[model samples]
Target chain A: MRTELTERFGIDYPIFGFTPSQEVAAAISRAGGMGVLGCVRFNEASELDEVLEWMHENTDGKPFGVDVVMPAKIPTEGSKVDLESMIPPEHRAFVERTLDDLGVPPLPDGNRVDAGVLGWLHSVARSHVDVAMAHARKYGQIKLIANALGSPPPDVIGVAHDNGVQVAALAGAKDHALHHVEARVDIVIAQGYEGGGHTGEVTSMVLWPELVDAVGDRAPVLAAGGVGSGRQMAAAIALGAQGVWMGTYWLTAAEYRLGATGDGPSTVQKALLAASSRDTVRRRIYSGKPARLLKTKWTDAWDAPGAPEPLPMPLQNLLVGEAHARISQADDAGVVAMPAGQIVGRLNSITPVAELIADLVSEYQESAARLGKTLD
Target chain B: MRTELTERFGIDYPIFGFTPSQEVAAAISRAGGMGVLGCVRFNEASELDEVLEWMHENTDGKPFGVDVVMPAKIPTEGSKVDLESMIPPEHRAFVERTLDDLGVPPLPDGNRVDAGVLGWLHSVARSHVDVAMAHARKYGQIKLIANALGSPPPDVIGVAHDNGVQVAALAGAKDHALHHVEARVDIVIAQGYEGGGHTGEVTSMVLWPELVDAVGDRAPVLAAGGVGSGRQMAAAIALGAQGVWMGTYWLTAAEYRLGATGDGPSTVQKALLAASSRDTVRRRIYSGKPARLLKTKWTDAWDAPGAPEPLPMPLQNLLVGEAHARISQADDAGVVAMPAGQIVGRLNSITPVAELIADLVSEYQESAARLGKTLD
Candidate 1:
């Protein structure tokens, strides 16, 4: 399964797994595929520094990356309070009424409503980039930085290159890939509408080839969205992608199957395992942008009639942050939401990261052999 | 690129091109790929029979197919008059106002408004099926019968199978493919959201692999949507598709570039040639269902504020049929609409069907070779 991407990232396999869990990320790296830790949940520079330090200590010198959500056009500017004020009262009232109707209880005493709203804003995301770059310079473990929303600014690309770290950006269209290439990013992850999180309407089969034909020679393109198996990995390579970027496939890894003390699967993990690909819906309830999330009462409420349109970006994230936090704290499966792709249908079991990687490699080999027979 | 599909269909390549033009369909079959003449525009059974007969005589012993749009769940069930009466007054006024605004003059001479309200209603489409089957039995030249909206009804499938004609249906989701297989479809064309005309939210890359994994062993799956290159064909095959079903690529073929007298491209063809992948929008302006079409004044008008939502299925088709005829007759580029896929970005030049098929084969070979190198 080695390709130009494996050589570029110095990994045994060219599978790039994106997740927020440090354990899952490190385990993926140890399993010979690059695990990219999402930094959007880190509120403070010190928190991100701690996560990076832990990853470095745990991965045994394997390559991993950091993902930051910095959209090219920030929805709002100035302080967090200013952005909060920009949200409409109707939207706020709808969210509150919806949460109340869902019968979600308030947090317990002494528990703060940790909405994790830090990296959603542009100013905080810039600070995240600074912290991650600084950690990369000091530890030399973070090999790549991926901007999830849009092309990284030229300065970020230049600084990452200067620090001996490569940069990647996710694009859902051919034009977006071209923009990333023009910005001089080292890699472009062509994500389709079927991908988890925020996505455009373009699907991976169409988006992958368009991105490859547009900028394959200029930069290595990593195929993302709806990719969950070895056959899909082989198909991505056949579509001219140097590698495959997977996110939803890792949510059910064994690391997430149980707590550190070995209790049982978390509420979110349980929901994912019990769900099918059709269980997810694309709505702007969690964030202002359309993101795929498990279809829960929270998402259904926002889509119902008389519900206000979601506020743009940071504002929407701000309005729903506390509701999400309360839902998570309550641990109610019917109301809890998780971002996932259409491939979630096939994610029926939890396995160790190493076993998953091995299965992927084996499946990829088998698929390639089958396709080879077609040519014969 | 000989696969089981090529052998099963007795064609030179595993490529199927769908178009409404008889000339383009015959040219595609003559060039080794199967040309499927879309029968949606033929209102009468005799008209379809005449066109099928013409295709039979001109294809030089090549195989061709007939495409019928009989949705599995018909929105309306009565006669065409009843369906026409079901259209709301506001929708009719809106269409009239939009067409008046676009400066599309009425048809010349004493030509009455031939709305051609044949394929939208269930009764008309049933008539179409009867005509196609009778023709198939008499001619023995039509090798395939494709249902665009859904799986062919059991009687249709049975009849086709009895006449030695294979039945194919288009699916945009995994469950849809399963349903088609349950209905005993011979082939499933898994189309993504990026495809032209009516499509579900699922994309081709995600949808293709899911469909293949679902029913590939039971029946052959043809990958559709955003497939305009040989590299994409190779990728689809790698994802487990037996062949590819293409539609938008044939819109700008040499057959469409010239009039019957070889004057110039039609207004619709010119619009397609000048369009980009991003220029298309999925709207219910023409049909009640959401379909991808070129973004023009007609589509944009319906998107404006206070515009009435389009009626369902046959009602919407009846309302817009005359307006479309007027716009096409006027040859106004701003108001003329045509169904297209996102791959329009790559359809910048027009070539003969033979040359296009040759290029696709060559590209498929090269892509397969490139993928083989990765496996090595």
Candidate 2:
């Protein structure tokens, strides 16, 4: 558990839990791993600041982090209304027809669906960084800032460094890992194709070793994707990764709630729990960039013949944002737009965050011993 | 290195080396690993019988195996001429145009192009099994018979068992593994998407554990795909596989000669040696089934717009078999139709087969020890 990642981050294990739920994030930090609260769901700065303050109060002084979706190439800087206006009419019509076909009704009265992915815009992401930096400066609880899209802008990295918070970025390929290192990012989360969210084509078994060889000397590499058990964690370490950065495995954690609406174990979680490793598909429908999502009726509809190609980032998210909102509210497992990994097959139960971490450690130890026995 | 596989097969290690070259297969057996010779390239029974005889003589009584491309369902049974006549004119024109664009010359005037994939037919694969069974009865060197496509027809499995040889089938999904076990295959090779030749969508990291949970009690699971080092092998064992089955890592072995014509270090080998993990594409261009290949000009041509959709199974193989022959003979690295895995990135050297096996063992031990230290 005490790799360079743990020592550098001052955490008990090299495990980094990614969740949008402050409850789960706080629970993970309390259980001795770094809890990274995803900030892309927060469009307003004050909403994120309140969550950070709540995280500060609930995490019992344990270290936590914030993840922002700052695309390396800033896309269309505009207000939410302007961005909504930019979405094509045909794309909106397609979404409406697909939602109608799926029978996912509109949100109930007074439930306003804002434009999707407001945080993906550069302006909103900047506000996210400002809020995270302010939290780091105020409570000293925020220890890291992770850029989900790519390497953060230089000014953002500088602000994070000035606040004494490490900056980390996720890379799916060797070239991207090298680029992150060249940009002086602190740590590289080498995510493979089986990972949840945006990923590259290489599977973790190959990509981890390739990336470790590419940037292990410069920055510690954490294996992401295809990780659901301690044996998998052992595999990551065996492949030369310093630790594991897991997101999907935390979805069914007992402490996890829907980040946007704070609902516990909704139909999305049910669908994810019932999935197999083969139940996920990689598509651009989730975020415009190809991300792994549960292969439900919603994804299948988008992939059907004659379906329009997904739009570019932010635009695509904007088009589907309201559809996603309606689906979430509908609680229909068949059409949920949930981001998950191939590891969804292994999430068969709900356990406390503390117990899950303990099990991971114990399983990791047993796996190491089993491997030793093989060599002997 | 002793696992259920090593114990059952009486091999020194749990490693199974797959290669199409008899020389390389013999070297793997001689080096204390079970070498599985690919039999799909042998179009004639006499050719396979002669190779099995040579394997018996060259293996020094070490355990070896034979792999045949016997799809679970039977395809058309016809003469090579009939199969050739079935390929459409448009497909032929496409191949010609693509090869011409790549600057690959036609074969010499006397050299004959094949109808392609004769061995994929049920008759050819049955002959391969018969030749292998004869070898098992005579010299006892053929310890196993593996079906590359799926669970071999029940009769093939029964015949192998009658000859006192074990049968192994490859599966990529939980349902496929369950079907194989239900059909009473002796061993299951859980191949992931990162594997060479034919593969499934699930990755080794996730597929291994899923297959193990599905059929480990009835059959031993051998992890295949994305394995280039002993560390990857250790990862497989830790994921509950009894051993590792690897093929791509052997492509550049000094002893590997092109099985078709016994050529050494051809342009195909050169291209594979130069590839990165990212330099592969999973396309139906190789065999009608989706297989990973070096992302060369040939594969790219097939993927280009206006290219005809690849034909199904033996027909597709038939359509492109002559093109493959010409490409192999022409020695054009840029357009070679080579079936490789994502692990091609690691095949940078042409070490002898014996040295490669040794490196794997030593690396496995080192990786196991490293995991042990992490746990400590």
Chain B TM-score for all candidates, comma-separated: 0.96, 0.96
Tens-digit per-residue lDDT, A15-131, candidate 1: 999999899999999999999999888888789888889999999999899999887887536787777788888877877788789998877774645457867877777887888
DockQ of each: 0.59, 0.79
* Model 1 TM: 0.95
Which lDDT values do the candidates have, in the order given?
A: 0.83, 0.87
- In model 2, state the lDDT of residue B345: 94
Tens-digit lDDT track for model 2 on A247-338? 99899988777733455676878898888888999999888899999999999998999899998887888888888888888878888898
Model 2: how far is A242 from its true place, Å?
1.2
Could you give candidate 2's per-residue lDDT for residues B112-219 as a string of tens digits? 655347877878888888889988999877888888887888888898999999999899899988999999899999999988888999999999988998885999
- The all-Cα superposition gives candidate 2 an RMSD in Å to the true structure of 2.0
TM-score of 2: 0.97
Q: What DockQ class does candidate 2 belong to?
A: medium
The per-residue C-alpha lDDT of model 1 at residue A294 equals 81
